[model samples]
Target: MRTTPVERPTVLRRRSYTWFPVVSGAGFYVAAIALPLEHGDGFASAILLTGISYFCWLIGWNSSFRFTRTHVSVTNVLVTTTADWRDVAGVDIEGGLAGLLRDGRSLDSIAFGGSLIGEFTGYRTHRRACRLLRQGWWGAGPGRRGKGPVPVRTSVEWRRALAIATALYVPVVLVQGLGG
Candidate 1:
């Protein structure tokens, strides 16, 4: 577990995929052994079925990764790569959150949950990080050069909408408070 300096958490996560392993194991156990369609020498068939099921599950498991507040972690069954958010220059959301760094290297965030690439969904987490970077909460370290350009899309629009909505509501509340 690498350490980071980010004090807040962004929305970067890949949770919808971890369930694939669980579902495959359970489905195979229930279908092939627990309640076989036909009862006749299922021992050999069950072993093969289990092998295939676990293979698919393992494949899904190894491909998922996540983003923490200060770091983005990409993992495989054997290796995991982590990059600090401070080094990111921009986040390209074409197919996934591709973090472009000031050093000219880019990392592809784990895109699971049918997130446009059949498995690349970290929309919320990506948005929060964009918002934080735009707010300067997760960017270049002082005295040290890091931080890149603002992501193409930032969360300020959402904040603006919220402000407009609040403005509309406050006037109504004020009117009610002064009148009979």
Candidate 2:
């Protein structure tokens, strides 16, 4: 009996330096807890915590980019987009990291771009990865190139969680502020 061949997945992730966000998030959380206990009311603490939470969330969420032989994926704060390589028209690194799709919608990558914060965010590695991805690797689509089509899928649980958190945060802060 003949068996079907299996394709291997090539996963490339962000190569960010860890100290900055980790240290900053820790500092903010510590301040959030300490500031309130020391002098301010719970309202102040709530706002501080919310701000820090949002910062940490973005830092954690948008810290990677991944691609495979079949599909390409871009992750940003709260969302990850996985699309067939064929679906992507091209990549744009002009303002930052972005993927232009055949549908005209662009997918932006968080940690994969050049920015003023590059010094602290380890954007160099991401920039290199972006270059590598744009190197005609996804030229597997049919028609002009005559390659083939790739199936794709995406996950949004993190985005949903972020949305839910944002929704709950406002109410919680308001209640605490008004209660006492």
Query: How well does each candidate superpose onto the true structure, as a TM-score?
Result: 0.45, 0.54
Q: Write the per-residue lDDT of candidate 2 for residues 75-142, one digit (tens) a residue.
A: 66556778767778788766566666766676676565557776466555566666767764455545
Number of the top-ranking candidate, with lDDT as the measure: 2
Candidate 1 positional error at 20, Å: 5.3
Model 1 TM-score relative to the real fold: 0.45
Query: Which residues of candidate 2, in runs, are more than 4 Å off?
Result: 1-19, 33-47, 60-63, 113-126, 135-155, 159-180
Would you list the C-alpha lDDT of every candidate in the order shown?
A: 0.49, 0.61
Residue pairs whose backbone atoms clash in candidate 1 = 11-125, 12-125, 89-148, 111-119, 111-120, 115-120
Task: Give one digit per residue, the lDDT tens place, for model 1 in 34-99.
Answer: 334344545445555555555444445444444554565454433456666566666664455566
| lDDT of residue 26 for candidate 2 | 61
Q: How many residue pairs clash in each candidate?
A: 6, 1
Candidate 1 lDDT score at position 40: 51
* Best-performing candidate as measured by TM-score: 2
In candidate 2 the C-alpha lDDT for residue 142 amounts to 59
